[model samples]
Target: MSSSRIGLRFFQNSRAAFRNATGPFRRPGAQGFRFQSSDAASAEQQSTFQRLWNSPIGVKTVHFWAPVMKWALVIAGISDLGRPAEKLSLTQNGALTATGIIWTRWCMIITPKNYLLAAVNFFLGCVGVVQVTRIFNYRRSLKDSPVETVKELETEVVDQAKAVASEAEAAVKKSN
Candidate 1:
């Protein structure tokens, strides 16, 4: 016999033994449906792939495909590993980290409890954090030298003054 058949036979025999052992302990008015061996046999005959495909969290459901689709983000993040830290966008990575954390938690509270989605989101958050940390450290290192810090402050002041002057010029032009 095939391994599946052998396993099914063992299961059936154990169930029967359990039912016999518990028969005397049943309440007088208690009623319950029993599975026929044939029904169990037919269910076992169905392939594992078929069973999974028909299941609640199977390929047909959004729970499955959504995680599959979200994997692209993880892949993209991984690909960015070679990218320069200076080129990394803090806001973009921050957004990914926030969404990943939020959705990973949401996955547990939602119906069917999509663990696959949670796993993908968790990895995505990890990738985002790694990139964010790299960017933050790179920016921090740039200001480590006093001269660089002074230059940055000077540039900020100059930029702000330019922006204010431009805004005043625009306001005067509009009033005229």
Candidate 2:
């Protein structure tokens, strides 16, 4: 599994997943190339890039996830301590941090001249991102036990030692 990092491709995939609500569709481009069916085809263009995906599908996704994310942010921020996993506490914090930055940026742009506060919030975003990144260091609970693993290693070592001893004894008898 990956130790998560944000990427443009991830956002693109997320947006596409929301738009299609199935998955990203690969299509043959007219110019003899591969492309995403959503963007490559002009006829099905739900909304332009400038609109920030306000189309029906996108709106539905946002509406569904917005409140959920808000509640999750509260819970994860309050209790989870950014627990890291494929789709657990780490994902929650990651989403929260990303949304915090987006909301802060939106506030900075929409509000009347709050550059100082925006700058502070930008720094807060940096802090949230750094904290969220800590999730990668977290270990899952339901994994193999270290003690059992060590015991298995010990058995293998003992068996190898016995094999080596038997080989040495055979060598000694042959020399005699």
Candidate 3:
């Protein structure tokens, strides 16, 4: 009848639709029950499964390996740094000179490599933590949202359609 009533009815229908859409998650044997269609229902199920699999823990575990590998490489590089420079050449002066040259070259190379590894590890670890937080937040939001039953959604939709039809009829009579 009134605009407010119409708006309220629309919201009620929408809420009902939302509930029907999410109802399967609440109980067993609720599959195939949908306000939309079977295709939409299946899509929802697939997306939910995807979200679960891509959860914070999963993302963190995947991202963790990068830093671990980086650190291992760094440690190996450090062990190489400790080896005798004399092994590079034969005579003492020659060995000293060769070792100096080798050590200097290695030091130069390792400086940048170590920095790069540190930077990569820091970046990846930060990305992993952020992804973990995002997944957790998404899951929390989904859990907090209310789910509706199909029966309630059907009833609400029927009520809304009737209300809209009645409003149209009343408007026609008023115009007449």
Q: What is residue 94's positional error in candidate 3, in angstroms?
A: 23
Q: Candidate 3: global Cα-lDDT?
A: 0.46
lDDT of model number 1: 0.80
How many pairs collide in each candidate, listed in order?
A: 0, 0, 1
Q: Please give each candidate's TM-score.
A: 0.59, 0.27, 0.20
Per-residue alpha-carbon lDDT of candidate 3 for residues 1-176, written as tens digits (9 for 90 to 100): 89999999999998777665654354433433222234446546666556445443233343335445655533443343344432321122222233333443443465224333345444434433433344334434545442433344346557767998999999999999
Worst 10 residues of 3 by lDDT: 86-95
Error of 1 at 83 (Å): 0.3
Which of the numbered candidates is closest to the native, going by highest lDDT?
1
Worst 10-residue lDDT window, candidate 2: 28-37
Candidate 2's error at 166, in angstroms?
62
**What do the candidate models score in CA lDDT, each in turn?**
0.80, 0.51, 0.46
- The residue pairs that clash in candidate 2, if any, are none
Ranking by TM-score: 1, 2, 3
Q: What TM-score number comes out for model 1?
A: 0.59
Against the hidden true structure, what lDDT does model 2 obtain? Answer: 0.51
Q: State residue 71's C-alpha deviation in candidate 3, in Å.
A: 1.2
